[model samples]
Target: MTALDTEVAQSVGDIRESYLAQVGRRRLYSGLALLIFVVLMVSGFNIADERNAGGFWEGLHQIGDYPGEVLTEAWQKRADLPGLISEFFPALVETVNIAAVSTIIGAVGGLILSLLGTRGLAKWPRLIPLFRRVSDILRAVPEIVIALVLIFILGGGPVPAMIAIALHTAGALAKMFSEVAENADLKPVQGLASTGATWTQRMMLGVLPQVAPNYVSYTLLRFEINIRASAILGFVGAGGLGYELRNAMAWGPGRFDEAAAIFILLFSTIVFFDQVSSRYRNRLTEGQAQ
Candidate 1:
């Protein structure tokens, strides 16, 4: 073959080698990542098992025992289930109320945070990082931890749960809302600004209208989450259906019926709100599509 042909063949060989090397590197990186993930999972499980009182495997096998006992007793006393449910209805209401109030307050806080943290809509653009960091910090702490801290200071009640959920919700929603805000058209905001609108006025009149549906949609979703959070907080003395359920469970055996009643109430309420929120979210999405 000619020298030209040999050079061309060498170039082709070089390209093939380069391609193989790239592929090999990618595979190596991927394999390393997977191995690291598996190691972390195994080690984490071992640590947790070591820390557990009953041993993870042993406890896992018995997980259903308590639930089965509770259900059997509850079924035996099914005749009185209606009365028990009625007795705990007010506690159920309180739990729902806690969720609702928290969602509203959190939505408002998230709205402000979103607008302030977003690039295009921030009133104080220089402080965007500060706002974003604040959002992160708020979201990092779990609602239960916040509730416990507040409970220590304020005593156990719905207020602690509400405030705890609201703070976490604000941070969670802010992150979501900022993403939506980032895509919003800037023309309306500019128009408002030209007319000497204040920062709040500009956001309220220009940005809010565009993002309101998504904001409401997120708020509704957060409300559902907060309901569960509120109940769990009640277990720590936040005073709701969860508190009643905890007391019933603590009584053991004889009180399983009451625990079952509270469980049913909490489950039914969650399902009902889930359906309602889903329906409304669909409506909002359809309206936006139109």
Candidate 2:
């Protein structure tokens, strides 16, 4: 065959391969869609089954029958909105306290771990395996499990929750901080070392400055998460809005309304924090850009 004919055949073969790849991609997407639909269908059936399992119809009827009473009680409390919020405010404050303390404690621990975590600062390559293994072990433990254990040991209050959050946060941020350290520009740290800067001096002027914004950013994010976590810890007897929520739910009738109010407060708190944190993050990003 002529060289021109050979080239045409090769071009046609390439086009055919591309067409097959596109067709395979479409089938893959279709299969994924089908899998998602099946999962939704199964989940729906399970929910329906649970709803109908007991004398659920009667329970629904009871709620429906007394809808007016529920509304009336909730409405009556409108005049006491300030009092209720005030009562719940302490728990909210406790949650904030827990979150703040946890973040601070976690960041300090992470900072210490980061020194070893940073590959650039690492002296012995043999130490890398030990640090990696330790970090891996730390990250493997979930915050919730830590809370459960602390609940058993400490037996109650925001202390257990705070410790739980701090431990997990330390574990998590240590890994992230280490990665940041490993990837950091080593020039400044190395140069500082070459100039006879003490380890602390080098970290303060060189490494710390480079990673400060990121470390602070992560700490802020952890505080936000800790707020939500403090709520769950409340279920296990940690003092927070979650405690109020638990009491309300368990106390029956008018209590759910109180719990719902607390939920509103908690959600608003989160929204406020989110706005503040987002603004700070944006400012930091802008500063970096400039």
Candidate 3:
């Protein structure tokens, strides 16, 4: 064969070899991943078995006793609906209150933070990093940890939980609000600024309108998360269904029915709200189309 033909054949062989190498690499990665997963499953089950000393299997054998009542058992038999709605619902209201109040507080705090975060607003330059860092620190802490600490100082109940959720919410909300402020149509803000509009006025007239729907959507979304958070806080004596859930589980099988019942109710309510929120979201975006 000519030198050109030899070179062409060599190039084809190189391409084939490269393709095989890539296929080999992918297969090797897949095999390693499967091995790691199998090891994890085996180890996890062994650890679980050691801890339970076969108690888990024993409990499963007795599943017939805890038949249906999902809500009570899930929340744990810590509360029945009559007792729950009458006594704990108020605490539930308190949780919702905390979420609402915190959201508002965070919204306001975030507005100020947003101003500092935005380059145009943070014209002073030195304040930008300061504001960003402050929010970073605030956002870095998890809400649950914050609540745990606050419970130590403030002495349990919804107050500490509220403070914790609020702090975290503010950090997150402010960061989002600031980012939104930064990215809004600058033309509207510029137009307002030219008309001697105050910063608040410009935000209200220009920025807010542009971002209101998104803000509302996020708020409702957080409310859903807060419901779950509040439920968990109950486990720590924050006073809600979660407290009952822990109690039921602590009491063992007999209480499982009640805990399951509460879960059914709690989850059902959350599902209802989610449906409502989804409808509202769809309605809001109706004009925009999918």
For candidate 1, write residues 13-125 as lDDT tens digits.
99999999999999999999999999999999999889888897778889899999999999999999999999999999999999999999998899899899999888789
Candidate 1 vs. true structure, TM-score: 0.92
Query: How many clashes would you count in candidate 2?
Result: 0
lDDT tens digits by residue: candidate 3, 1-290:
69999999999999999999999999999999999999999899878987985566777876766554443454554435456445445545665666667666766676677677777765456788888888887778887898888888888777777777767776777687777667778788889999999877887897778777766766667667777777777788776677776777788765556555566557776787778878887776664354
The best candidate by lDDT is 1
- What is the Cα-based TM-score of model 2? 0.81
Cα error of candidate 1 at position 106, Å:
0.8
Off by over 4 Å in 2: 1-3, 6-72, 123-125
lDDT on C-alpha atoms for all candidate structures:
0.94, 0.79, 0.73
Root mean square deviation (Cα) for candidate 1: 1.9
lDDT of prediction 3: 0.73
Q: What TM-score goes with each of the models?
A: 0.92, 0.81, 0.74
- Per candidate, the number of residue pairs that clash is 0, 0, 24
- Local accuracy of candidate 2 as per-residue lDDT tens digits, 1-290: 69999899999999999999999999999999999999999898678868775655546667654455545666777777667888888889998898889889978877776676666676555687786667667667776788778788878788888888887777788888887777677789879999999878887888888877777777777778877887887876878888878888788786655765787789999999988987897787678678
Superposed Cα deviation of residue 231, candidate 2 (Å): 1.5
Residue 107 local lDDT, model 2: 82
Clashing pairs in 2: none
